[model samples]
Target: MNKVLCFDLDGTLINDKNEIIGGEGTIHALKKLQNIGYKLVVSTGRLEHDIYYINNRYDLKLNYAISQNGAVINKNKELNAKLLDKDEALNIYEYLKTTDLRVELNTVSNRYWHTDRDPDFPKEYYDSSNIVHDFRNVIEYQPAVLFLVIGESDKIKVVQEHINSNYNKVKAIRTSDSSLEILSEGISKGNTVVELFPNSEIISIGDSENDFSMFELSKKSYYVGKGSCNKATYNFSSIYEALKQIIKGEENGQ
Candidate 1:
């Protein structure tokens, strides 16, 4: 059986500025591991297109990519998606419309955002490509994986808590201080990875609350930066360092 290395995107693969400063070193390590027969997988909360966008823009490559926090998987050029319930999505959408939060609905192919974009929402994180004034009219026609609410930390918490308290079919989690993400209950990166590779050894690397579930399922895990992740097996300042260490361990027969 093969060993799979799964890593998060935002804080792990790229820096806070969205640049891969350690590009050459990380790419070398990844290529060496691939040559040694390791299956490299990029697991992220980003949508499929965004994953490819980063890969192309940075010249980084991986054998497989898991997107939408595990709701969508692209393996061997095939797409497998686990979409949220349409009615459940609509219910959440209806409730979110009542708030001033910047809501983004992520489908397998495209992302639709609320027209009432909050001015405070970080410009770097907001994508203005697709904006829908109202999702109710087309909610039933599209397949969605999750919904994202972006705002002040306090407002994000309030929406997350409300959804957790009222919604049975979906669950909400704080992915970051300014963002709250909602996905179907029981759907997570860890769960999806385990299901995809039942016989392989799993190694996870990430830096936030959303990566905790993936860490829990990993045989060895590394937490990047100072973010909280009690489940990680080790801590590193950057993904490049983690990859170097992983390569060293593999060469030493660990």
Candidate 2:
């Protein structure tokens, strides 16, 4: 059976500025784990290209990339995806239109935003790579997920409750104070990981609520940094420290 180590990208592996926290040490530890026959997986809410970008930029050489929470997965070179029902997506679009929230549709490679543009978000998301579409027209893409950016922290819970209560076809998870993730019901990081590697002994490392699913499936779960995840088996300061502990666990036959 295979041994897998899945990591959540943002706060777990990289910092706020997108820099690898442990730098060379983190890379070395990952390489060592792979050398010992462990499969490395990056389980994140990021897009596919961003996964490749991290591997290329950091030399992480991950064996699998679970993108968009769990809507898409790249196992080695093969792609597997589960898209939102277009009608359900449109239903959400209509509901979100009633609010002042900044909305965007996320495909495996691109993010489509309304052409009217809300200045609530940073210029980074409105970059040249992502598409600009009029949400009033159609659900332009078969999105893997929808990002609803509610800039106000107070309204975040209210919006999440509204979506979860009204939508049976989709579920909304509060990924951050300003953001909520909407994906098809029953899809999650844990389900996807177990589906793909059913016989493997898994370990999860993350720092947020979305990572909770992964944590639930792990043989050992590590919650890094300060993000809220009470389900983790342990907590660590940095990825390097966590990786080292994982190595130590193996050495001690844990």
Q: Which 10-residue window in model 2 sums to the lowest lDDT? A: 120-129
Best candidate according to TM-score: 1
Q: On residues 148-205, what C-alpha lDDT tens digit does candidate 2 reach at each position?
A: 5555766777778888999888889867667788888988899999998999999989
Q: Once all C-alphas are superposed, what RMSD does model 2 give against the true structure?
A: 2.7
lDDT of each: 0.81, 0.79
CA RMSD of each candidate after superposition: 2.5, 2.7
lDDT of 1 by residue, 1-254 (tens): 77998888887887756766377887777778888888878888787776787777766667788998888999889999887889888988989989998888888887787574556432333352477788776568877788988889999988988999998888798777788889999888898888889998998888787888888998899898575456889888888999889998988999
Off by over 4 Å in 1: 116-128
> Model 2, stretches more than 4 Å misplaced?
115-128, 131-133, 136-144
